[model samples]
Target: MRENTEVVVVGGGYAGVMAADRLTQRDDVTVTLINPRPAFVHRVRLHQMVAGTHTAVVGYQEVLAEGVRLVTDTVTRIDAGGRAVELASGGAVRYDYLVYAVGSGSADPQVPGAAEFAYPIAGLEEAQRLLPVLAAASASAPVTVVGAGPTGIETAAELAEQGRRVTLVCGGVLGPYLHRRGRRSVAGRLAALRVTVLEGAEAKVTAVTRDAVRLADGRELPSAVTIWTAGFGVPDLARRSGLSTDALGRLLTDETLTSVDDDRVVAAGDSAAPSGLPLRMSCQMAMPLGARAADTVLSRLAGERPEPLNQSFGAQCLSLGRGSGVFQFGNRSDVAVWFHVAGRLGAKMKETVCKGIVKHLADEAQKPGGYSLHRMKGGAGRREALEAVRAEAPAIERIS
Candidate 1:
């Protein structure tokens, strides 16, 4: 009997789940998905979880394909030469093809006392931990949310809508990704909610204390609770496994999502850096990348040429509490355009997007090849740009 082509996918985020489910399209392949948690985490709803508005979890039974084997465990190391992965439980699983999709976490602030005093809600557990803390706090307690990105903005709005006194410390321009009009809309909504928005160099948080946050401008704000959504950081598994990775430890891959070090390995989602240029760490790109990664593996298995990735973005959706939102439209290249939708219409659009995300995943699980996305026509240009960079850097050529 001919043995099945074994594919082991690490991580259970949007990308990993999509990749694993899509790989089930091939009858000759067996897919195994390894993750620490049994439930799928809707990271976008973590702020809702923190605010007691919604639970941020769903079961894999609803999202994962029937053929994909689910393993509730953690991967400690990847042995490329031996084609095996060492599990924390003292065993190893060999694979013919490996998908590296371990996603991101809250970045360490590296500020004095920040780690000990501040709360991070990047993951499910972190959000769960913050829920009770918020519930126990006084109604008028001063709450500070660090960072002005989507996570920070959503967190502050959710809490403020619940009658908490919320302060948003932007540390820089508010909504750096938003266009002027979009930013104005967001600021207006925030102001209407009675939430204070602080920006510029002076708003940059330098340190966190037990009951206050000190800023670079030498101003201290009384923060009964400090929520840090400043930035995200991926796991160091790729770097530790001796794989070629970017400075942030994302596994480096070609446009086809194949790892630079070994053709048998592929990467997807936030953990993947393709041709040294990674997309923003968001689910907006994860599912498509995951499907693309699976296609690359299927092509290799069938001895066919794989196509390069052609990625594009259309909008950046932000939920400002339950009844309000901002859907800032963007060009194909992900640059924010002047057009946007705000108020209840934007909120409905945001709600549709959140539901559509899960629906896409579920649909992919049922019909892998049916899923499709907008493709950019800049593949050759990207390769040329990478070549130019390699010529100047020399060492980059080896990875390219």
Candidate 2:
């Protein structure tokens, strides 16, 4: 009889959950998933959680496969040499393979007073913490949302729709990832909601005070509540565990998602930086990456070589409010094009996408190894981009 292979997946977000479920394809493999939260967090709808529209959480039982064991605990470190992970509570869990998917969280603003005063809505806890702060503030309070990314735009629009005064301080151009046409559509929506859009270099926030925010152009805006959605930062678990990582602290891996230091260890989601070229941190890439990571493990267990990553994207969707949205069409390379869907249709499409994501997870739970979106072709652009980087520094060492 073949021995049972033990696989431990750290983190319970989209990537971790998907990997754990897919790993159950082989009956001889026993999968265990470790996460800090008891339930699955719908990270894409975090802004909705802050705006009091959705709970942004689902019971793990609803999405995780029955064959997988869920451990509600935090992983403190990964002992690659011993093939075990140290838990925060106590003891350790041994594994034949480890999947590192401890995804991202709110980045340190680094600006003076920003961390102390601004509220970030990147994770479940962070979004939950902002709920009461928003509820306590007066309806007429001037809420300032820093950053022009999707999170900031969504939060600003959601709050503005609630009749609260909103000021969006874009450190750079508004909707930097969107085409000019899409940006115009978003600008129109924000204007209709009475949100004050501040862009350009002068709009950059320099400091945050209890009652106001200072800008780079020596202007001060009265802000009763400040929300920061600038950028995301992954946990330093990889670096702390003595594992090699990229500059942003993400576990660096080869094209097959295998750690350069140990073939038994793999990475996925926002915490993974494959070939030093990480994909954008979003649910768009996390689920596919999760499936790919599981495939790598299965291939190794079957004594076969694994394939490299080949993920593609379609569009970037953003909800302006409960009734308005914009879907910016992008090429396979994820670069925005001139085509877009705006207004009510865009809103419906955005809603469908959010619902589809949950459905995809639930469907994969029922049928292991059935997910195939990650297998789509069109990685030529990615290969070219990686080759360019490789040519620039031929001697750069691979890290994991």
Candidate 3:
């Protein structure tokens, strides 16, 4: 009989959970998931958590597969040569395969006093930290949300709906990824919610202080609470472990999500930079990446070459408030198109998606290998885009 294969997934986010659950297809494989938290964080609902709408946490028993062993610990470093990972608890877990799915968190704002004063809502703990701060502030206090990405927009709308005075600092264009029409819809919703929408270069935050945010135009806006959601940054685990990583610290991998340094190591979700080109860091993309990463390991175990990434995005959903949202449709390549669903319907769509994400994970746990969205027939645009970049420069020089 063949020896059992041990797989270790180093994250419990959408990607890591999906990968670990799907690996149960083979009885000869033992799966272990390591995460800092014991519960699965519903990151999509973190804004709602801050607004006292949802708890944003689910027990691992509800999502993780029965066959998988749960390890509640943080991975400090990966000893690739030893095929083991060092844990913060002063222990190690050896594995025949490792899936790097440590997802993203809010980037360092780098603005003065921003780190000291502003709250970040990218993770569970960050959102929880903001809850008490919000409760302590006066009801009439002005709240400033920095960055106009989905997170910033959702947070501002959520707070505004709760009767909190809110201002959204776009930094540049509001919803840079949204179509002009979609952007207009979002603007209308924010206007209805009484959120002060600040955009353009002049609206960029120059600095953040305890009681105010200074804009590039030298205007200081009173802000009792400041929330930063500008961008995301991955953990430095890859770089610290001597693994090849992109400029953003994402694990550098080949088309098959296999690490260039070791065949036994694969990557998924926001932390994966496959072919130096990565999909947008979102829950929509993470689940597919996780499934594909598991497929890569399964293919190798079967002595077959794994297929390259072929997933495609359909839409970007943003919850404006409890009753308002905008579902911006996108082509297979993920670029926002002209079509969108707005208002109540959009809110319903967003809610369905949020619940569907958890359901997908739970369903996959019940039936391993049943989730096949990652293998859909698409990604031609992704391939063409990669080829165009290759034509202009060498692959090594085209990291974006």
Where model 2 places Cα greater than 4 Å from the true spot, the runs are: 394-400
Instruction: Per model, state how many residue pairs clash.
Output: 0, 0, 0
lDDT comparing candidate 3 with the true structure:
0.94
Candidate 3 on 191-283: residue-level lDDT in tens? 999999999999999999999999999999999999999999999999999999999999998888888888889999999998888899999
lDDT tens digits by residue: candidate 2, 1-400: 9999999999999999999999999999999999998999999898888888999999998899999999999999999999999999999999999999999999999999999999989989888888888899999989999999999999999889989899999989999999999999999999999999999999999999988999999999999999999999999999999987999999988888888778899999999998888998989999999999999999999988798888898889999989999999998888899999999999999999999988888889999888899998754678898889888975233222
Worst 10 residues of 3 by lDDT: 391-400
**Cα miss at 92, model 3 (Å)?**
0.5
Instruction: Show the colliding residue pairs in model 2.
Output: none
Give the Å shift of residue 292 in candidate 1: 0.8
Q: By lDDT, who's the top model here?
A: 3
lDDT for each of the candidates? 0.90, 0.92, 0.94
Residue-wise C-alpha lDDT for candidate 1, range 1-400, written one tens digit per residue = 5568999999999999999988998888999999999999999999889998889898898899999999999999999999999999889999999999999999989999899999999999898888788888999999999999999999999889989999999999999999999999999999999999999998999999999999999999999999999999999999999999999999998888888899989999999998888888999989889988988898888778877788767899999999999999987667799999999999999999999988988998888767777244533445556678778774332212
* C-alpha TM-score for every candidate: 0.96, 0.98, 0.98
> What's model 2's overall lDDT?
0.92
Give the TM-score (vs. native) of candidate 1.
0.96
